[model samples]
Target chain A: AQSVTQPDARVTVSEGASLQLRCKYSYSGTPYLFWYVQYPRQGLQLLLKYYSGDPVVQGVNGFEAEFIKSNSSFHLRKASVHWSDSAVYFCAVSAYGNEKITFGAGTKLTIKP
Target chain B: GGIITQTPKFLIGQEGQKLTLKCQQNFNHDTMYWYRQDSGKGLRLIYYSITENDLQKGDLSEGYDASREKKSSFSLTVTSAQKNEMAVFLCASSIGRGTSQNTLYFGAGTRLSVL
Candidate 1:
């Protein structure tokens, strides 16, 4: 069975620091990768996605993720973080052309002001 | 912008009682899904619908029933609420399956508590 793993349970970074949240996926074929963020008491919001061609994908809120096929990793990143960037980040993977996504446990990001 | 709405922001029920949660999407998406989120666990799929009147069981569909009344609405019912059960029920929708282009959109979610 295909699965997604996010190793970190929580991460804390200063307001001006950079951020990286790791994600790894297990699948047989090419994977469709996605990053989603959930704010407190809010729904999950799409941050970015990677399908084909581009290994580097940009998302909303100045976030981007690089899909590294070799290591089965898709890590989310931001050049500089802000105070409002605190949220739980989830990494998801889908079988090629399948809509059913397997999500990671998620990493809670806390921005220290 | 389109929106997904889940009714009853918070639900409280007694053990063994039947409870239902409703979801509506204005995006006209062909697919809708229901998921459960525990305090520290990832979202678990419960049930889904490909279109109106079409239902599919997901990984965690046992003990739950789902209904797609129409293209714009879907409802999930707990067959029998269990005591000490507490989780967040989320409703989501997407245009189609296959590619990352069809991103899932979610509602605020309905928090359920059973005592």
Candidate 2:
């Protein structure tokens, strides 16, 4: 079975501090990973995705994620976060490009000013 | 640039009443999808269409009927609205439906409430 695990249901961080949202997946075949962000009263927006190339993929709003095959994880990170960055993040896994994706429970990030 | 538009931003229907939600995308994408998001439950796929006149069931398609009358429009119908049922129905379109990896463009979503 293929699945995504977002270990932390919620995380809090101070504004201007570094932040990391962990995500792990279990799939037998090669995995295609993606991170999406959803703001309150808004639709989901794609953050980034990882495929065959570089382990670290950069996304919009100065966000990036590193794909670790050995660890079965693709965690999202940002050097500094603002209050506006606080939102719900979802991690998804697929067989390959444009295939059916299984998503994690999602991690809610809270930034304290 | 393309946008996915969902009609009836807010809908309130009676129990056992059949409700319909409409979606239209101008991206010329091949696939369109309908997903339901509960208060705490993650998004659940309800129905998807790969192209014009093609309908595919997702993990949570029971009780829902979808239509792909044209390449740019897809609609979903609630067989029988349940009382006190509340959920947000999201519409998305992508180049393909086979992979989760495909970047999906979503609409603001329709907030549904059954009385």
lDDT of 1 by residue, B14-61 (tens): 999999999999998988989898866788888878778988787889
Instruction: Considering the true interface contacts (CA pairs under 8 Å between chains A and B), give the fraction that model 1 also has.
Output: 0.46
Candidate 2 displacement at residue A44 in angstroms? 1.0
TM per candidate: 0.95, 0.93
**Cα lDDT of model 2 by residue, A48-97, tens digit:** 99977899999999999999999999999999999999899999887764
Q: Rate residue A39 of model 2 by lDDT.
A: 91
Instruction: Name the candidate that leads on lDDT.
Output: 1
Worst 10 residues of 1 chain A by lDDT: A94-103
CA shift of A48, model 1, Å: 0.4
Model 2 misplaced stretches (Cα beyond 4 Å): B97-101
* Local error of candidate 1 at residue B54 (angstroms): 2.0
Give one digit per residue, the lDDT tens place, for model 1 in A4-113: 99999999999999999999999989998999999886779999999889899999989999999999999999999998999999998876556676778889999998
Native RMSD of candidate 1 (Å): 1.4
